[model samples]
Target: MFFRQHRYSNLIIPISYFLDLLIINAFASLLPIQFQTPVLFHAYISFGWIVISLKNEFYKIYRYTKVAYILRLIFTQFVFFFLILYAFIGFFKQPMISRLALAQYFVFVFIAVFTIKFLNYISLMRYREKIKGNIRNVVVIGENKKTNQLISVFKDRTDFGFNFMKQFSAKSLDFQKEECFKYIIENKIDEIYCSISELQNDELTQFINFADNNLKTLKFIPDNKKIFSKKLKFEYYDYIPVLSLRDIPLHNPINAFLKRAFDIIFSLIIILGLLTWLTPIIAILIALESKGPVFFRQNRNGIDNREFYCYKFRSMAPNNDADQAQATKNDMRVTRLGKVLRRTSIDELPQFYNVFFGTMSVVGPRPHMVKHTNEYSDKVDKYMVRHFVKPGITGLAQVRGYRGEIESDTDILNRIKFDIFYIENWSMFLDVKIIFQTILNAFKGEAKAY
Candidate 1:
């Protein structure tokens, strides 16, 4: 329900933002500059600023997020806008881009969009608190230290919204069914949160049956399971509790949505806008060098143990899946055109489609073959934990020199360590920095690129 409402809320700002951009562009065109260039540039600039705002998490509807937090985010958005504008203008040395107009547009957009978003967030929080609507009522089913801690945290934080109608002790089987029924009847509970270890299969199944009959939500709070230790950070949703088993890096919902939104829009621009103009040319070269399929699709594990077929331009002689080998330096399978593609990282362009499909991120731990996953899971400790988040086109490990074939166990271990570090310390600034470093590294040709 929250997700649906959030989606509906998103529609309002974007619509208002589009009108604001149109006005900004209209204002930009009035100035003395190239008519089309400045107009389009301002439009692009507005779009970029909006994306940065969303990426920086100005859109997350926090129930009790301090007013100071909201202002800090707004200030960060202004900083990003000016920084990006100046950097791009300086890098391109384009004097025609109207600085004053762009600055005005930034101010205009920030005021209009920021006000709408803030109002939406404040209004939603008020609605949830005022009408007592959309706040999930949750019951914790456990009698252990973990449950005690959970209760203590919720009791101290009223903004969490769980109301904490009652916590049922899971110590014994006697009076379990009757007490559970009584709690349901008296409290009018809407959900159940349980510690994973506290309940056996039979008890869990019984509770699940009751929950199903009662039409309540059942989410588990996992203890520091080794798998969760990799990236999970549990958080409460109002009074309702949830276990965050995987960290998608963008903690703020709007930031995460923006990162992904940009990935899709950017990937579409690359594939449809750019690749359409480049594919036939590259295909001819590949066909001339090697008579085989022009693309390669391999099954790779993605976030949450899902498998997706990752695509890349064929740079090798289409090896059989039954007898595949990882590419090494000066491999015989690579064609002359393939070498150029591999060196320039053009072969991975097709994966923009993977990003568009929501199976990959523009930056994250790169996905490996299922066979490689199995082989390395045994060799490297906590290797599978990297699969908690969507694999990326480029990652912190790749930037820090842990790409290419894992020749040593230490290499794989260090790579996993870096991947986890990136996951834990994820922020928009970090992602932007990694992307910049990736571009610079590609230009200098790192040793791991092979």
Candidate 2:
């Protein structure tokens, strides 16, 4: 009776994703360069494309969009889509993806997708009418603040096509459930917004049954207290219901896998290409400057409160307070070589092995000392949330001048804030951005790095 229903419309994007690929390959066949698939290509595109789409939220639609909006989404989605595509090709060591063909494919795809958007927009416009054809009459059956807010929203958002009907106070027992249902029928009400807290269980059940039996929609209006946090979402299993805070993005499986995949590849490149020759020279420098071992190892808290021996070049000489105290500026324990290592950020490079071993990541919350982890989790808000993702060699906090020794509670608080933000809103693009910024900051040298 309203605008449209999209029960099967979810298939449009998935089908179009592959259709664009086929059109690209068709035109690419005309060129001298050929696109060939590797053994992993089947495993990747078969299930991975759908998983990537799900991660990128390319399918879910809560409302219709203008053609411009759809075009923007298409461009952004394809950028990420191809980012993962190229990542897979490089990670699996597959045959070369044809650059010319890939470019031509998108050119054609943009044109085709552009046309498709206008068609969808036109179809939606054709379906929507000004009066009863595309509008729904809804009423509020409660007198609470939340109910008022709901009514106000419906009244104001004319684009939603909600025609605000009369509201009745649930306090007035004069309006019984039967009478309310009768009123809804008389008014041709399309939805009933009821405050569950205001109604008796039996009365609520009666409204529910009536709404179902009458083919009218019923939406529960929850009091603000029940919501607690804006991040909470509801899910159902069989008949049981559950409310959960939305999982941080890095904690999601597809996202975690992508981060780990990049970690392994990036770590291997440094370990094999750079470390192969650079390690022994740094080892000699450490041996000459210090009396103890070439590497310093200490336990640090990792993902899920687990502790692991994080590695670093032995910057500070052997000290009894190594694990308990943080390094201070002009500390005697720091050797000349150690000062250079700390200043240049080379001391943190050994953690690349942690990344390769799956214990850490290349970009994340910098691992805290076990003592600091225990101390700050109590003092800071949402500090433990940082541990939700693997600790990193460098992170958003480090590049943003929140790195190094904590001089005040404000320092740790700000650092934890950035760490939590990175965990909650992570993306491979963000990781890359953080990595580049970190490299730039390293060259500039951090004053409080010690």
Candidate 3:
């Protein structure tokens, strides 16, 4: 569900940064440390502090982040910052910079920073809990055990700042989408939550699209299947897991920028370091064995359901079904070399170009053939949700053994589940893990690789 904007919330990080530097410099001045140029030392410390904080995500605190996590971040940031401080002293050869004074300065800075940070955190919590500031008005669209638990949370946790407005049953004959929209508009609801089990795919899509169009937050109460994945953000209301539909980490601008930067650097490394030499060899082999072009390009559905020409090293003889059919185990269409390339996953390497060009990501939901996208959009519930992020050359599903031929309904379903998980829970760490797993799978061999 949507969060109401706190006027000062946006300023919290910048203000914290400012106060932290202020404390560092102020403590330095008070401590008995001789400096050649006080202004230059201040500048060095300030720049070093900013760099360390950015690297460590020191101020990336969230409402749901625990006090322990915040404390851990503070500890980590200071340890690195402490090193930076000493490096400056050592580099400048400031013999007059007293070691005892530096230690004293650190203790003072730590206490001051710690006190101010917690003071702000505790103050905000108290304000939200006691005064009900920064409140968000939310409504539930279906009745179920999870929804009831969530309603209880809204009622019990005043500090969360959720104002429970009303609950409407999706199963009731009186229920209408238009009526719910009208109520939301009249009541000025900030968030809408639906019970995924109660609503049809069409109804779910309608609510999702409506939320996007109206600029309201939409969340879901997952059914009692215990389908919680590591990637999806589950905000625990007491014991109930409430799933956020659009709370993807990559949706954050800073996160998006970081992922994009990583994609570029990684793709460049692969393209320049490996593909420059490997491509010609593969291309010659494919040409010698096949009548068609060395590279295969087929239309695939990507982010936002847009079609793009996905590239692959041709592993099969030229065929009309290239765009429509998936390669199956021991398929006659596959050339002898194709089997090795497919099994090794070398055939998929060319999509690094797609990652570099921005049509795809290094780790995301694998794009399906355009025809399959249309067929599955109608057959599979929440299938289109995977298109919310760019398609990937290798993905969680691939590493989890759900790649290649969609032999059964369960196959596609499981793949989409993992894909959704990747989209929801994406981190640089997760991406790297998936890539490593992909590499291991390639070397170890996969049953469905063909």
On lDDT, the candidate that comes out on top is: 3
Spell out the clash pairs found in candidate 1: 160-238, 160-239, 161-238, 161-239, 162-239
Q: Estimate, for each residue in 1-450, the C-alpha lDDT of model 2 and write its tens digit.
A: 323221133344544556645544444455443446433454554465466557666544322234455566677767775676566657766566766655665566457655665565454445433343356688888887767776766665454456788888889858676677788989888767777668776776667556644546566665434533355544321222223333467644446666777999999999999888888999999988778888889999887667999999899989899999988889888888889889989998899999999778999999999999888776765677676678999998988898888999989988988987887789999999999988887788888877
Tens digits of per-residue lDDT for model 1 on 43-82? 5677776778568865554554666777887788778877
Candidate 2 residue runs with Cα over 4 Å from true position: 1-231, 239-241
Q: What is the C-alpha lDDT of each candidate?
A: 0.70, 0.71, 0.84
Q: Sorted by lDDT, highest first, which candidate order results?
A: 3, 2, 1
- For model 1, give the 10-residue run with minimal summed lDDT: 3-12
What local lDDT does model 2 show for residue 91?
78
Q: Count of backbone clashes for each model?
A: 5, 0, 1
Cα-lDDT of candidate 2: 0.71
Pairs in clash, predicted candidate 3:
231-425
RMSD to native for every prediction?
Answer: 10.8, 16.3, 9.5
By lDDT, the better pick of 2 and 3 is: 3
Q: Which ranges of candidate 3 are over 4 A from the true structure? A: 1-175, 178-246
TM-score per candidate, in order? 0.55, 0.55, 0.58
- Top of the candidates by TM-score: 3
